[model samples]
Target: MSETYHIPVLRDACLEGLNIRPDGTYVDVTFGGGGHSKALLERLDNKGRLYAFDQDAAAAEQAQKLATYPQFQFIQANFRYIGKFLRLHGVRQVDGILADLGVSSHQFDTAERGFSIRADAPLDMRMDTAAPLTAAEVLRTYSEAELHRILGMYGEVRNAKTLANALVRARQQAPIATVAQLKAVLEKHAPKHREFKYFAQVFQALRIVVNEEMGVLEEFLGQCASLIRPGGRLVVLSYHSLEDRPVKNLIQKGVLFGEPEKDVYGNFYKPFEALHRKPIEADETELAANPRARSAKLRVAVRTEDGVR
Candidate 1:
């Protein structure tokens, strides 16, 4: 098997934000390559516990070489069911939660995964390879209107209408199969830049759909409110502005779904304490080392007695 390198982004920031307790329980909700988990484990004593969740089984293969430790447990499941997975492990609340959201370098670099537009892979962009839906299925099955809306909203492509129409017309002639095939069909729809922001957005949208990313994130965030202990930190790194916007609003306002409420004492009851008003970005050094950190926006919040402030 080929070794896949999964570089954890904002490593220092995430570790600092976690404020890890040596003997405290922690959860790595998106344990892509065990980068953060290894760091967390190194800080913990034998008594300290760490649980990791990843729907993709392939994501866990990297850390199999670690010495057997009772304190560390890796679960093969979606982070969306964090609550359920933790329950099975006999865990109720955790001291910290780390979520590194976005496609892992391993996934993008692997041609078979169909995440990178540069690779001539199949149109199967499921982060969790076991996931039922693939990009090809969506492209071939979804109505042109649905495709247009996905590109417009999720991808934020300016020429979504033209692109969707092109895709629809192309599919009628021949079913889209590989990345290069799809690229060829939509070449006219993309901007002057071939491998720049234009195609990135389009690929992002397809990955989001294949993985059901936004929905999973919403579910996972809501679970964090209940899964984290008071004072436990919730740290997330989102790559897309669309993904970061919701996290920012949810962390600061503490109200994700409904209007905010205030008690008679004029003190609002919030579930979490927003660590910073704005999301943090990668520093110059980290960015230079890893261009993936360029789009990273890190958000940190502490769980409060009441939901996120």
Candidate 2:
């Protein structure tokens, strides 16, 4: 595994949550750097199989190293199509699924990928390079209203309206094709002592929109609910509330949006049982070593054999 690709957060917690059976099939939906996948494989015996998914070319290149392991198979595709891909591979259900939702550390460290605020790279934040829309395209083509909505909803940017207007106004004179260009435009509106945080939020908003992260996450979670067998586990590690909220709701309530329906007896039906009432966070030891783990929230659930309410 490439040390720079990504460091799995809450490794032990996630493994414990999965409760792996020695010979059961498992899937690591976000196989960045294969850290989690490697660990999962270590726990599985010869009869066990591990399927890993990734869309980024860089991650795919890195995954080739794991190919020598007979128990391992790598699928180069976005996890949003996990169900389709699994069915194509002759898999109907899995014993466990693990998703580490952080954009890989390597993606941020490689300046040209444009996932970092500290870099001066071209505004391209597509996790899947083949994807049609890039961050530059989103900024250039999206309307002021669209920009504002994404910034507000995805990034929680405080002055999304002002920032959106500023971006539109700046683009009128010249294209905002690079991080440096976008930073300059936002500098004028950034609050005192909060410029870094503001830039981070803006970039996050653009990346989310360009990647359609929220929609993809919803689809993946929906598939997880259906594809995990009874007593199987669904383990997710989300780096932001935008991602964590849906995972938490879907696992506990069986619905991605709105409240879960209740029976005449006033009891709500749950498809999975939450293993941990509160999300597991990185310990101080891990946090000190990996600052990225600070924002991570790990949630786990086990599929149940209950009837509808």
Candidate 3:
């Protein structure tokens, strides 16, 4: 695991949530630089199998280092296809699944990837470089209304409508082909003291759309309900509310969008039980070391027998 690639947020808490058994099988659905996977491998016995997934080409290089472990298998694919990939490996059920969602530090630090507000690069923010849709394409193709919705919902930008209008107007004059152009066009609208923060939100919104993060998260969480054993655990670390909200609802209420409907007994028909009443955040020490951990929210859920039935 490359320390510079990404530091696993809430590592101790995530491992505790897993309640790892010496011989149990587990999956790390977002391998990134294999930080969490390597940590999991340390806790597992020789018989305990660990499967990891990542679609990024760069992550494939990191995955190769973990190939030395006999109990480890690395699948180069998006975690949304976790069930199919695991089934292909003859793993029908796993004791635990861990997903550290959102973009990795390596992705942001790489200038060519265009995932950072601080970097001036091509408007391409695909987690999988092989992915077809680029941020440039989204900016050029999406309607004003589409931009408004994504900026508001995914980025939580304060003036999404104004920003959307500004983007549309700027693109009409000349294509917004780079991060520098984007920042230049929207600079006037940014708050006087927090220009970089505003740019960060805009870039985040673009990255989410380019990566299809929300849709993939919904698909992955649905599979977790069925793939985990009755007593198994599902631990997720998400970077924003857009990702965390659905995870919370799915774990607590078994529904993606809202409160689950209750039966006459007033018990909600849910697949898993939330291990924590509220999402966990990183400690002050961790926050001081890695400011990125400040936005991270960790949630743990235990699959129930009722879900399997």
Candidate 4:
């Protein structure tokens, strides 16, 4: 893997959370740069197995570098289907599963990916190049209300409704097909001096909707409880609150939404228990080396016996 593909965030903390066993089976659902997968493989023995999943073709290409490792295998698909793919590989359960969510550094830095506000590229922020939806399509076809919801819910943009209306009006005049075109519309409404942050928020909203990230994450997490053996770990590194919330809920409440239901005995049922009350943040040392690590929040959970059912 190219060193610049991505720098794994909270690497040591994630490894420690996994508490790897040499002969155990493990999975890295977002094997972006294969940095975490490569590290996991190094700690495993011949009997151990590692299954990695990545929807991005670029990441799949990066996976080639680790193809020599007999213990490692890569699945070029979104992790929403993690259970289906793992079962096809004869893996019904694993000792640990690591999910590093959100866009990778390579995706953001690549000018053509349209993930970064810093560059002017086609509005194609599809994490999987093969995916049908693109940011451009979302902007061009989505209703103003649909746009408002995503902008507010996914990106937490303050003027989502206003912006959504503006987008609809602007697209009527001409298609907002590129980052530059979209930014031209955004510049009109963006708060002075905070234009960059505002642009990033809007981009994040569009990217999430285009990729169906939150929905995919919920599906993937739903499978995790059943796919991890009792005592196994689930380590997730989420970059934003939208990604972190479900992980927190699943670990704490054993459900994606709402509070955990109480059993007949009046005790709440939970599949996994959080290893820490608070999400772990990158240390000063790591932040100094990789500024991208600043927003990362690592959460680890252990599957309880209840998860096996």
lDDT of each: 0.84, 0.90, 0.91, 0.92
Model 4: clashing residue pairs? none
Give the per-residue lDDT of model 2 (tens digit) for 186-230: 899889999998898888898898888899899999888678998
Give the clash count for each candidate.
8, 0, 0, 0
Q: To one decimal, what is the Cα RMSD in angstroms of model 3 from the true structure?
A: 1.6
Q: How big is the positional error of residue 127 in model 2, measured in Å on the Cα after superposition? A: 0.5
Two-way TM-score contest, 2 vs 3, winner: 2
The prediction achieving the highest lDDT against the true structure is 4
Q: Which of candidates 1 and 4 reaches a greater lDDT?
A: 4
User: Could you arrange the candidates by TM-score from highest to lowest?
Assistant: 4, 2, 3, 1
Candidate 2's TM-score reads 0.97
What would the TM-scores of all predictions be? 0.94, 0.97, 0.96, 0.97
Deviation (Å) of 82 in candidate 2: 0.8
Candidate numbers, best lDDT first, in rank order: 4, 3, 2, 1
**lDDT agreement of model 3 with the native:** 0.91
Q: Which regions of candidate 3 deviate over 4 angstroms?
A: 264-266, 307-309
lDDT of 1 at 11: 85
What's the residue-level lDDT of 68 in candidate 1? 77
